[model samples]
Target: MDGFDRFRAPPPDMLVMRPLDSMVAIFHRPSGRTHVVASPVPEILESLGPDPTDVATLLARLSERFDLAAGDREALLARLGELEAAGLVERL
Candidate 1:
């Protein structure tokens, strides 16, 4: 994959998001599971639209709305991995 992984959220109807104080509760319809996510995780999910997006593009989109640190790239990659594992996001 050249280490430039692309990701996309499932269809809107497949997931339901609810905001809690510092976390978001996401219900994955297909799995009948709910995931509790925090911080950049929620932002990341919100940034992903219907189209698949690469890391660079996703970072750009996030930057427009949030103040990101230089080390965020590594953190983002790690979070994406977590989200993928949780079925919250799909790696395309």
Candidate 2:
């Protein structure tokens, strides 16, 4: 997908996540498994929630929190995609 396409969020019921001090804990209740991943920046963890956040919103928040350059933003998003693909986090 192109960069613009990457900005799209996944559907709800795909995953759930909770942020801790230096990491984000993702739970896949349906599969009865969890993943604990260290965030690149602690601020990113703070921006996540039980509520839904679209990819654009997430990137925007990250930019504001970390002042990340475009490349950094894309890289961080790639990591998030990996987590999502693992079913650790859902689109909702």
Candidate 3:
């Protein structure tokens, strides 16, 4: 897969979350670190479900849940890269 076409969220049990006003506090069990995130970060993780997915499929899943602009592709990719770096998402 090219350009981040294969990715997945960590298992559901690996994460614990708390809503903090406009942001979210995420406890990543494996990393033993808490990450504060906003907007598409959590949404991306949720949309990833329990399976690895390509970028197109992931975008379709997200679109089903939110009004994603056509131009948001780059932003989506950037966010996925960020999540991957943070260990919140995994590359396959």
Candidate 4:
């Protein structure tokens, strides 16, 4: 997917995540599955609201807000792919 293709965070009613030290465990209600992740994944999901956010905007936001955040552009894209596969994010 390209940067122009928007992505949406999982609906709050359907997905929930709780912090576990530096990592987080995201519980997907519909799928009845949990995904544990760290760093940019949780931050990325938090920045993604109910509205769709393109990769460019996501990257821009992260760059602007975080000084020591992990993952460069390539890694960020890969992380997005992982989130999509986990059903934590969806294409718009």
Instruction: Name the best candidate (by lDDT).
Output: 3
Residue-level lDDT tens digits of model 2 in 1-92: 23343322323354466777767776656776876777552244346544566667777777776766757656866766775686544444
lDDT score for candidate 1 against the true structure:
0.86
List residue ranges in candidate 4 displaced over 4 A: 68-71
Higher-TM-score candidate among 1 and 2?
A: 1
Give each model a TM-score: 0.90, 0.54, 0.92, 0.83
Worst 10 residues of 3 by lDDT: 1-10
Candidate ordering by lDDT (highest first)? 3, 1, 4, 2
Q: Which ten residues in a row have the lowest lDDT in candidate 1?
A: 1-10
Q: Candidate 3, residues 1-92: lDDT per residue as tens digits?
A: 25657999888899998899999999999989999999878899899966989888998988999988877777788888889898898888
Distance from true location, Cα of 31 in model 4, Å: 1.2
User: What lDDT would each prediction earn against the true structure?
Assistant: 0.86, 0.57, 0.87, 0.81
Q: Of models 3 and 4, which has the larger lDDT?
A: 3
- The 10 consecutive residues of candidate 2 with the worst lDDT sum are 1-10
